[model samples]
Target: MNRDKVTEDRKKLGDFGEEMAKKYLINKGYTICHEKFRCPRGEIDLIAKNQDDLVFIEVKTRRSLRFGEPFESVDIRKQKKMIKLAQYYMNYYKISQVNVRFDVVSVLLDESWDVKEIKLIENAFY
Candidate 1:
């Protein structure tokens, strides 16, 4: 496949994973606040509310584990970026004094694009 096609496919997969993550969170009692929150710096996959805490979430999806588990991709650098983006989001919305949490949702899909497993890691970072 060409680069464009590959990029498009990846984007589609990401969107699928995010939708699944949202549903999972909703079932677990999280309120969806935003999706694909972006700024001049970067984008956050999802922002949600879990009772008293504002949760910033990163969804990572993969069809296979050749590279590693999806959550493994969120390295320290990525964590820092998420933190900055979360701060930006809060400032943009004038949100303060609420408990904050960082979370990672890992979605693994089978060859047919069916979800194989979904894992939620709360407080994945500071």
Candidate 2:
């Protein structure tokens, strides 16, 4: 495929993965606070709350694990950026008393955009 097509495909896959992650979280009794939360630093794919805990979720979607596991794509720099964004979000919302956690949701999408695997990692980072 051409570059544009590849980019489009990736974006579609990512969207599908995010939708699956949202559903999964909801089923696990999480309240969806936001989707695609963004700031000058970066974006957090999903923000949710379970009771008093605020969750910052990073969704990584992959067609295949030929390169590596989907969560492996989140590098240290990316983690730092996500943390900063989470802090900004918390402060902006004036959520002072809630516990905070970073999570990783890895979705493997099939050609038809069906989720083949969904892995949820909680407390993934400090």
Which one wins on lDDT?
1
Per-residue lDDT of model 1, residues 1-126, tens digit only = 899999999999999999999999999999999999989989999999999999999999999999999999999999999999998998999999999999999999999999999999999999
Best by TM-score: 1
Off by over 4 Å in 1: none
User: Candidate 1: deviation at residue 63, Å?
Assistant: 0.4
TM-score of each: 0.98, 0.92
Worst 10 residues of 2 by lDDT: 107-116
Report the poorest 10 consecutive residues by lDDT, candidate 1: 82-91
Candidates in order have lDDT scores of 0.97, 0.89
